[model samples]
Target chain A: MKVGVLHSRIRRDEKLLLNELRERDHAVHKLDVRDRSFSIDQAGDQFATLELVVDRCLSSSRSRYLTAWCERHDIPVVNSATTAATCADKVRTSLALSEAGIPTPRTEVAFSIDAALDIMDDLGYPCVLKPVVGSWGRLMARIESRNMAESLLEHKATLGHYEHKVFYLQEYIETEGEDLRIVATDGVPIAGMRRSSDHWITNAARGAEVASIEVDSELETLVANVDAAVGGGLLGIDLMETQDGYTVHEVNHSVEFNALNSVAPIDVPSAVVDWLESICLETTAVSS
Target chain B: MTDEACIVCDATVALPADVELGEIVDCLTCGSELEVTGIDPYALEEAPELEEDWGE
Candidate 1:
């Protein structure tokens, strides 16, 4: 099958896929999205005769728009454009999860500082203040008091970016120094890891130690519900334990599995490529 | 004249005759990895940091 790789930089994740594709004897076309322009028609000769294109661009905006363009031209892209857009924005993901009755942290949004502070009141103190459009816990803060809330709001107001003022405050789930990062395809868990850290934020990128974990029945149910809510694709679902149960905080599009690869017993990248081949081959069989 | 000016300094760094996007070129003056973002006029941007972060 002819495979088109849409990427800006080749990280470990992409390198794994590229190597697997080569080993499998599939033709790989590396489409650097930075220099690729979208025409209303074919875009360019690079897109011709491609069976599947993977959206792996580093920038959310670029990946979303380019995938949309590909869809317009009747091309197939894994983790389609709609899924990318929904997963990229925190507010949209929240809405999708809430509407589907998925258990997520109690979250509130406000446009003004006063309204945000009022929301902080409803959620109570020690809640988290997070940027609406970031990952790996960048720019996320824990507001422990009303005074801190006021100061954060003031600081946020002075920022130039519009996203800064759109406050997304979430209830800080008190867990036992860990959270779950499960990599799954559609609704099925491929590999699961426990990110443990001394700090409140347990993201693997933030010096958290990673160890493999078992996928319990409860986790399976939650991820299945989450996959349905997010429209299904290769995704990373983040969950935190609460007094009630496990509440999913985020689902990432174009998820990274290199860290999970280290601890998981299963060959993570090979499994992913096998899944990718299955999907592409099945689709090609149908069309031809 | 297919060279692009180094983003670090105003010194010109010669680009390959068939420069493609995502190709990393080095700055002769400052020794920074420059990525080709454009080809028509040969534009370059500082290579993005490669640190793995929480998934996007």
Candidate 2:
């Protein structure tokens, strides 16, 4: 079987995954998403018929387009475009989590600046301001003062004239140590990492060191429910251990698993491959 | 751009200025609705460069 890995440069984990696949005697094709002319036809040809597509594209639009194209051509994409879209936007993720009865930080979304200001006033200070569509802690600010909130809202309002997408305001939870990184596939929590803290952002991209940790059944169930809600095959759930309990901070669709593998007890790559193989087999059976 | 006279009742007479896309304004005449359309003023402008170094 052959697999096509997208955005090879940005996701360094693709190399590790590809190496793992090669060791297992499966053909792998790495494609750089920055190549302008690398269309579906080119990707199909390069991989000599792709069994599965592993999307790691940073741009949501490009990722959606590619995944849709591949799906239309009978390729089994691990995380579909629909799932990616839901996971890419923080507002949507929060809504899904809330609707699924998962415990997440209290979040409010408002379209207009006035509405946002009102919400900020009501929600009180020390709330997090996050862009609707952002990743890796970009454009995420913790606003403690009412004046700061107003200034941020005004800046966003002045800049956003095309359309008013609601900005996310989440309640900030203080954590004693690093956050938990739970990696799940098919509603099953495979492995977890307890990040070593230096920064508030516990993302691997944020320079957090990884340590192997065991996830309880309750946490696994939470991750599974979230995965099902987003319709993603593989997901990364970031949870903060607040005084109340573990509350989900974010869900990532295009998660890089290199750091997780280094600290995980299981063979992370093998698990991923096994999941992809089952999905591919099912898809092939359905089509045939 | 049309020279058609304002049709709304109790409308204050005002000449229509060139409006770019996404700009919002209250109708001087009927105070109903006025939103700029057909051209994005900021479309051609380069996106403001972010200062964030996302650790590559």
Q: What would the per-residue lDDT of candidate 1 be over residues A43-65, giving only the tens digit for each residue?
A: 56668689889888877777778
Q: Which run of 10 residues does model 2 chain A get worst, by summed lDDT?
A: A7-16
Give the per-residue lDDT of model 2 (tens digit) for A79-110: 98778778877777887888888899889888
Q: First chain of model 2: TM-score? A: 0.90
Interface RMSD of each: 5.0, 13.7
CAPRI-style docking class of model 1 based on DockQ: incorrect
How many clashing residue pairs, candidate 2?
0
Per-model B-chain TM-score: 0.79, 0.31
**lDDT score at residue A166, model 2, on the 0-100 scale:** 67
Clashing residue pairs for model 2: none
Question: Candidate 1, DockQ to 2 decimals?
Answer: 0.21
Cα error, candidate 1, residue A207 (Å): 1.7
